[model samples]
Target chain A: MLEARDLACLRGERVVFAGLSFRLEPGGALLLVGANGAGKSTLLRLLAGLLRPEAGALLWDGADALADRAAHAARIRYLSHQDALKPALTARENLHFFAQLWGGEVAAALDALDLLPLAELPARVLSSGQKRRLALARLGLSDPARRAPLWLLDEPTVGLDAASVGKLGALLARHRAAGGMVLAATHLPLPMPGAGELRL
Target chain B: MALLARELRLALRHPADTLAAVLFFVLVAALFPFGVGPAPETLARLAPGALLAAALLAALLPLDRLFGADAEDGTLDQLLLSGLAPPAVALAKAAAHWLTTGLPLLLATPVAAAMLNLPVEAWGAAMAALGLAAGFLSLLGTAGAALTLGARRGGVLLPLLVLPLAIPAVIFGAAGIEAAASGLEARPYLLLLAALLAAALPLAPLAAGAALRVE
Candidate 1:
């Protein structure tokens, strides 16, 4: 179980959010909803251990999660707005690099996003939506043998098409079926079903 | 090693950044002979300082983009969350910088020194001293790059931050070349250059890694 108690955040001199609390159980999915200036991205970053809370405690399985940051990080798969690709590298080479860093089957991950046909093309040549799909392909690269239990996604479906959205929905369903948890912040509809909503 | 391999692959595909730095190094050293009269003795006397200074400046040219590109593309965030220590990431960058930038500079050092009329006796010492100096510069550059990552006018700020710290490398490098030219022992100066590298090998990555984690 993941739990947050009275979390607060500060951006520059302004307070983004304060006195926030939530709980996420095993196999649970939480969708974050808020207006443009709301703290959805900040909350996802905090949960991913990218940003520190100004005040509050985060607990995982009834223990302090932030105390051992590397351990916490190992359990997370985060996808931000940017595609995070090298323009000079081919799509296959790009996915292979990440696979080498975090154990995964590269070909399978590429296939998951239907990227095998364009695998030889340099990322720079891919369209914006294709780049987003390529980024989503990373989600499938997590080793099923030792899957990262928690996924923190920020605007994951931004540039994807209708067909790509269906593929992503299947991926999310499989993750949840395997007892994984997802915390996503998005303005669009996601594939998650019966998910709890958190508004900022 | 994955990060290092990825960095090398990226560099190989473009090849422009590496080529630009080396060309700049040779060109800068070549300019010195023209600015000063081409008298052989004058060229010989000025070669050590001119060559070393040019190499140092050339190394500085690529430091601004060392971390800037990764930050802009969001690759840095993935690296931070990869579960590898941040120091290890910074170390890989330093290694790649040396391999692509420093190694090329060292390979071209003899040609630059030759053009400057440096004696054959000093060539070996110049290469040795420059090898050490280049590695030291890579480390210092990594730290400076990380510190100035998100700052305004970072390209302008990088040399201002790294050049002062690089004085020792030039001092020892030039002295080693001068010693060899005069038939004196150059080992002492070369060792000093190595010592500076030894000190920076551990400290620079640590500082750069800490800076990376701040955001």
Candidate 2:
């Protein structure tokens, strides 16, 4: 459902990755692997429509994603290292805000991640690990009008503990079960079975 | 609609951030009397201009933070990708800023002016002018804030970028009040300030949204 042809990305004056091409069908996952500063985050942002490719085109279902930016934005959820949590808001409020933005079910996302217990606490008081879990819960929300979305995640498991990592795998599995796709850039293996890898 | 609501919720949750700008407005206007001395005539003459300038500067303090906070935490990217038009996001931010900072400054303008021995007759025009001027400052300031997002030393650079653009508001704002104080028709000055607002209402958000794309 997604395709990139000779995608050339640059950082400042340097061309981090060039002549890159990939295609992923619905329910597929692409694991990106490369050395530091090899443009994993850049690749995710490029696909998420946040950054334009220095050269190349991104196609969603045979249509130019760049040309139809709003459609591309609607169909994907890009999660970078930054959690995007408002520090002053409670955990549930933070999730609810994003859920409302994305047109997803707030309660379902919370239930999926077992975050109900910590919902009332302000995000500033949450530990890094809990914060990551909260972010993961945000990623779990689904728009019922559409099917589950395409995910462009940058090191999503960085602050997750083993249990949270396992929960993440389960979440991915559920998303895939519902015919969603993921393109995750990670240093550590995501334990996503049947996933294909692309080294930058 | 949702973006505006979310901004209001966040602002309500963190009232102190908005309060700081309002307090800055009060403090800056308060200090003008002390600096200019106890002469009521001199203070009255300075009140309209000083209050308008104070409100403009105070608005600047919170204006930069409108987008800066979200940009830092990656919320701006998410907002962009939330399928809402980028221009609408800029509009929501500009509106929230007015609600929090401009509205408070307008409400306090009477008390603030009174402290400087402002005549009761001029309060209506002064408040009306300050209200409209504050709205214009917010729209212009937000465009600057969005333009400077992620730039080095953006806070220091913001005023230099926006204040020049807002000079019309400052001039018309004080002029309207002064004209009214003399029992003259203030419509010409008020009309000019209103024209500024009407022009900026559509253009500023578009400029700020375009700036977001470049950033």
Candidate 3:
């Protein structure tokens, strides 16, 4: 389980959100919804242990998340707004590089994302939607079945088409049904059923 | 092992980059004789400095991509998220940079030496000095690459940041060669290069790791 208690996040001098608290149990899907400057990404970064909270604490299970960062990272995957694909490398090369880092199967993940045809093409030649899908494929492959239990996504569906968005919704639903947790920050209404919404 | 393999793979894929640096080293070494009038005594006297400078410039050419691409592509975040510590990652990056850039420059040094009219007897010592100096420069370059990450005009900024730091390596490298030519011991100059590498090996990575955390 993941829980944030009295979490206050400050971006520069402006307070993004203060005294914000939420808990996500196993098999829970919490949708983070807010305005343009609602600090949704900041919140997700904090949960991922990428940024420190200005006030309050984030706990995973019974331990402080920040205190055991490596342990936290081993079980959590955070996909940010930037997909972070290297344009000089091919889609398959990128997946292979990341798979080596996270220790997973690259071919299976590429097949799952329907990217085998474009796998040999350089990322620079990939369309924006295709690039996003490739990035998602990397994440799916890297997320170890036993280790990755929590996923934090920031605007994952921004450039995605309707079909890709629907595919994402189904993927999230399946992940949740398997006792994993997802905290997605999206402006659009999610298509998944039984997803809890938190508007910032 | 994995990081080294990745660096080698990246370098191999871009054969033009490695070839260009080697070509630059050879071309730059050849230019000195034309500029200074091809008198053997004068060429031999100026050989050490000229060869060292060419080697430094050639090694520095491809360093901009050392961490720049990974940082931009989000591979840096994944590296940070890996179980390895930031310092370990920095060390691995420095090693990779040396393997790709410095090693090639070291291999091309013999050709540059011949072009500069260096004495045949001094070849071995010159190569050894350059090997040590290149290692130090690679570490320093990694710090420069890290500092310039995400900055506007980073390509221009990297050389500015690294050139000054490279001065020590240049000095030691040239001095060691001159000492060898004069029949004097080159140990003192070699020791200075070794000292620089020792200090930079630990400090460069810490600076790089901190730079990665910068917003």
Candidate 4:
């Protein structure tokens, strides 16, 4: 399980959010909804252990996430809005690179993302949606055996089309069914069954 | 090890950048004779300074892209979230920068040496000095790149931040060549370069890692 208690975030001199709290168990999905500048992305960063909370603790499986950072990191994967791809590299190369980092199956993940045909194409030639799809494919490639149970996605559906959204919904559902927890921050409504919503 | 492999693959995919730096080193070395007049004694005297300057410029040219792309595309954030220590990632990036830019420059110094009319006996000493100098510059450049991550005019700001730090490497490199040419031992200058690299190897990564966290 992942838990956030009394979470507070400050950007510059402005307080984005304070005293936020939530818990996500295995097989659970939580969608974070908020207005622009509501600190949704900041919250996601805190959950991913990319940013520290000002007045709270993020705990994973009863241990402080900061105390056992590597264990927590191995158990979670966070996908940000930017694709984080090197523009000069081919799709296959990018996947292969990240696959090596995460110790995943590169070929299978590319096949699953329908990126095989564009595998040799440099990411600079890919469209925005295509880049987003490629980034999502990284999540798939990160842990094929579903060992990383926590996924924090920030605006994952922003550039995805309806078809890709449906594909994502199915992927999230399968992930949840397999006892993985998902915390997605999105403006668009997700189609996952029994997914809880948290509006900031 | 994986980071090194990934960085190497990335470098291979963009051969233009590496090629450009090497070409620049040779081209800049070639220009020295034109500007200073081609007297053998004068050419030999100016050779070490010209080579050191060219090496420094070539090594610094691509540093902006070290963490710039990663920061812009959010890979830096993912890396921060990857559970790897910030210092480790910073070191990996520095190593990558050296492989792509520094290594090529080191390999190309022989050609640059010939272009600059460096004395035949000074070739080995010159190359040794440049190799150590490149390694030192690469580490400092990585830290500078990280420090200027999201600043306006970052590309312009990088050299300004890094060049002052590069002075020590240039001094030691040129001193080694001068020592070799003057029949003095080059060990002192070489030692200085190695010591600078040693200090930078640990400190640069820590500074770069802290900069990443701040961003």
Residue B170 C-alpha lDDT in model 2: 87
Put the candidates in lDDT order, highest first.
1, 2, 4, 3
Q: Which of the two candidates, 1 or 2, achieves a greater TM-score against the reference?
A: 1
Compute the lDDT for candidate 3: 0.82
DockQ of each: 0.82, 0.74, 0.51, 0.65
List, residue by residue over B1-215, the lDDT tens digit for candidate 4.
67777777878988998999999889999998899898888988999988999999988888898888888889888788776778788899889888888888888988988877787788889989998999888889888999998899999999999999899898989999989988888989999999999999999999998888777
In terms of lDDT, which candidate is stronger, 2 or 4? 2
Most accurate candidate by lDDT: 1
State the TM-score for model 4: 0.92
Give the per-residue lDDT of model 2 (tens digit) for B1-215.
Answer: 87788888888988897789888888998898889998999998998789889999989988778899998898888888878888899999999998988998898888788888888888999989988998998899889999999989999999999999989898998999998888888789999999999999999999999999877
- Overall lDDT per candidate, in order of appearance: 0.92, 0.87, 0.82, 0.85
Writing each residue's lDDT as its tens digit, candidate 3 over B1-215 gives: 67667777777877888899889989999999899999988999999989888888888888788887877776787777766677677788889877777778788888888888899878877888888887887888888888898789888999899889889888998999999988888889999889999999899988887786553
Assess the local accuracy of residue A151 in candidate 4 as a C-alpha lDDT between 0 and 100.
88
Q: Model 2, stretches more than 4 Å misplaced? A: none
lDDT of 4 at B195: 96
lDDT of 1 by residue, A1-200 (tens): 89999999999999999999999988899999999989998888898888999999999998999998899988989998788999999999989988987889988998888899999999999999999989989988877687898999999899889899999988899989889999999999998998999999
TM-score of chain B of each: 0.98, 0.97, 0.95, 0.97
Instruction: Please give each candidate's TM-score.
Output: 0.98, 0.97, 0.89, 0.92
Of the two candidates 1 and 4, the one with more favorable DockQ, higher being better, is 1
Best by DockQ: 1
lDDT string for model 4 (A140-193, tens) is 766565468988898998878888887777778877888999998989887767
RMSD vs true structure, all candidates? 1.0, 1.3, 2.6, 2.2
Q: What residue pairs clash in candidate 4, if any at all? A: none
